[model samples]
Target: MPATIRDVAKAAGVTIGTVSRALNNYSDVNCHTRERILRVAQELGYRPNQMARSLSSKHSKNIALVLSGFLEDTMLNDFETMLMKGIYQFAFEHGIDIAMYVINSRTQKEKSYEQLCYEHNIAGAILFGLKTNDPYCEALAASHRPCVTIDTEVRGPCISNVTLDDVTAFDELTQYLIDRGHRKIVLVHGRKNAMVSMERLVGAYQAFTRNGLTLTHDSIIYTNFLREEAVAGVGAYFRTHTPDSATAFLCMSDMLAIGTIEALKSLGYRVPDDYSVVGYDGLEVANYTDPKITTVDQNIKEKGYEAAHLLYDMLNGIRPAQKLVLPHTLVERESVKNLNELSN
Candidate 1:
């Protein structure tokens, strides 16, 4: 049989209320007593019944994670998947439960932030893929629930965010390509409203200006980050223009990069030999391509883990720093060749 709280209290020579306080991390209990109870509970393998505790405490001890796009959508990239894994792992460690709400046209309207909080008795929420003018963010802020956003920003008193430095990372990546003697680069980006896309575009432009290269409007392509969209976009471009028009292609995500490669092959154009490709989000898929894609490694899994812990801290009444920006690295691979070498 599993050990009970009462059993733990008796073993530790503490009152039932004291045991509860210690286990729940309530500050009312003395430090020495809390430590003693915790040690005793561990020795006896005492595990609190989470459901029962929630019922008694009137706090669900559960967090709601609202994903802004469908699982089948192109937005569900490696960054999203790894980030969710990190949230789950952190929540589990802290004895909290997570409920996921996948956002789509139907669910987005059906579920309101107020209704979700009231229905689930949620202690907090984590939002991924927030738009600059999203109504949900406004609602969440008004609800006054402790919330955290990953890869997006939200404005609220109790909300915090975790993200990468998109402009700097992208600028560095594009500059790397420029240094390799690649000119006439094509940029394939996501939705214009996405914060990341905007920041990346800024970085891309900075790279062009610094290198004294001209960035034409026609050189940029906007896609929904879908593999199909990437293929169709590149295919159409190649048909209307010449393969030699651009020496390298820059993709905002690995999924797009992979699609670009597929389309290039189908069109009988060789990667690196004919066109070099660079991708963001160094997903494992990047390495599997025929000529592996060069990309920026954003340490996605760690980002998730950190986001989870940050939210956990907020829930526990510990206000952590507002913005947590993780580091990024550029992974050099086969997809991009030094045009200088070709010139020489």
Candidate 2:
């Protein structure tokens, strides 16, 4: 038989109410006492009654991790791996259970978000891969449930979001190329629906505008963050424009950069030596590449960690709906060659 709360309370020499308060993370409970109660409860195998807790104080200790449209065939990349690690780290430390709720446009049409959350026993959600321009985001904004999105921008009464400042980071990154005297640049961008991609495009535009350069329609290649798409897009772009028509490729993702490098190699060209290249998302693989990638280190893991924190804060009313932008750094490496005539 499972130990009751009363049994654990007795073992810890605390009142039943005190045990309850500690378990619920009430501010009034002493930290030491709370730790003792938790230890005692664990020792006795005390499991809180979920149904009863939900009825009395609303949904308790359960969150839904929302994922949509991630690549199913490939292994998880370093950015994704670290992001989830950070989120689970917080959940484990807080004793909160996580349930994955993967949905897409079709699923939303079949069942409403509220119904889905109810069926999953979800108290709150950390959402990923949502689009700002999609209709579902409008519904999410109106739902007023605690939802935190990663990289997607959806504003609502109860929505909190966490992402890096894409505009500034990408602006600085694009400018990095121009400063090195790269006038002929090709922008390898992402899908039109994603707001991050749109914002990053804005950053690129700003850099081009300030430098009296232009991102012509013909020079932009669109991909869906797929390496294969990057390869095809780059290949197709070069077919229309001569190999020397562009001196550099600025990619929106490291995966795309890796693919771009592969595409270049297939064409008898070398990175930096022939056409300079750079990428975003400072993945570990970026460093291990033959010549390390010049990319934006956007602190991807911290984005997930803070997404968890924002949702937790909203759930507990510690803070209202918040938007947190973590810091980003431009890591320049061997993937780019200085074309500014500073060559020895």
Candidate 3:
């Protein structure tokens, strides 16, 4: 067992309060006595209780990364793993403790966001996977706790959001397809309530409008951001609609885009030959695909670093900005074919 302040006090022939004052650099203790106490502490291998010390100073010295709405494989996904690496590195370098929590429907029912933070002694939090309409998001916005969210923007004095500029990302993606002479495009989207899905949809619409093209209501399909659902949605869409109806598909996520590719192959359709496919969220898994995926790289690690720093700043009463839009790039690969060549 390591030594405590009481043990150090006894060895140094001083009161526990005196030893604590010396350790805390209170200046009231004599220099000689303070030095003797520190020497005894060092000899006894006494390590201060960081948690208790933080409590005394009114700072928890701890932050939480909240992952909400995931039903399975909490940390196995490439995006979540990369984001967590950034947050973990930042916390380690800054000497702050970090706790990870996965919130699902059952957990949400058991504890509110504030309750979870309080129980964990978290000074601030970085929240992800929350839809804009989630009850926890609303509660977080109403509370004064320092919080930074990804993708969803919650309105509050202490709440900040970090996300890719979806409008610009998707606008560029759709324009890329348009520039290839693709006038017929299919849009595969995620959850309807998610803020990101809506933003990307807007960007897609803007691109089509920019090229003097109008998308009918049938051009859009929502898959709720699930792989199985995306496969089924694509299958169902093509059940009635011909493959020739759309020459390209703009998927809101790599997972969905990958599923679409698999579904097309299963139905004997070749990507970029029969139809081109584009995806968002430049997941590492995208590179392992047969033809590699063309998607928007959000630089998820940098976003995670920025989100953690944003919360850290907010905890210190420094409001950098209510919303931080990280830059993203379009990674072009073999998935997109030049429709102009086909026309020629």
Residue 277, candidate 2: how far off, in angstroms? Answer: 0.9
Instruction: For residues 1-344, write the lDDT of model 3, one tens digit per residue.
Output: 76788999999999999988877666588866865775687668665687345564434356888998655632356778889888887887887777888886556644556556544566688999987767787778777678899989888877899998898899999999999999999899899998999999899999998889998878887887877777888898998897679889889998889888998888999987888999998899999997799999999988898898888888877765489989998999889999798668
Predicted structure 3: clash tally: 0
lDDT of each: 0.80, 0.83, 0.83
Can you give the lDDT of residue 213 in candidate 2?
97
Candidate 1, residues 252-277: lDDT per residue as tens digits?
88888888888889988899888888
TM-score of each: 0.80, 0.81, 0.80
lDDT of 2 by residue, 1-344 (tens): 77898998999999999998777667788866875786687568566787345443334446888877655415466777778888988888887767776677666555556545544556689988776655468768877578898989788888888999999999999999999989999999977888889999999999999999999999998998878888999899878888779999999989889989999988889998999999999998999997799999998877888888889888998989978889999998999888988654
- Runs in model 2 lying further than 4 Å from the true structure: 1-61, 71-75, 342-344
Residue 122 miss distance in model 1 (angstroms): 1.3
Candidate 2, pairs of clashing residues = none
Off by over 4 Å in 1: 1-59, 72-76
For candidate 1, the per-residue lDDT at 38 reads 61
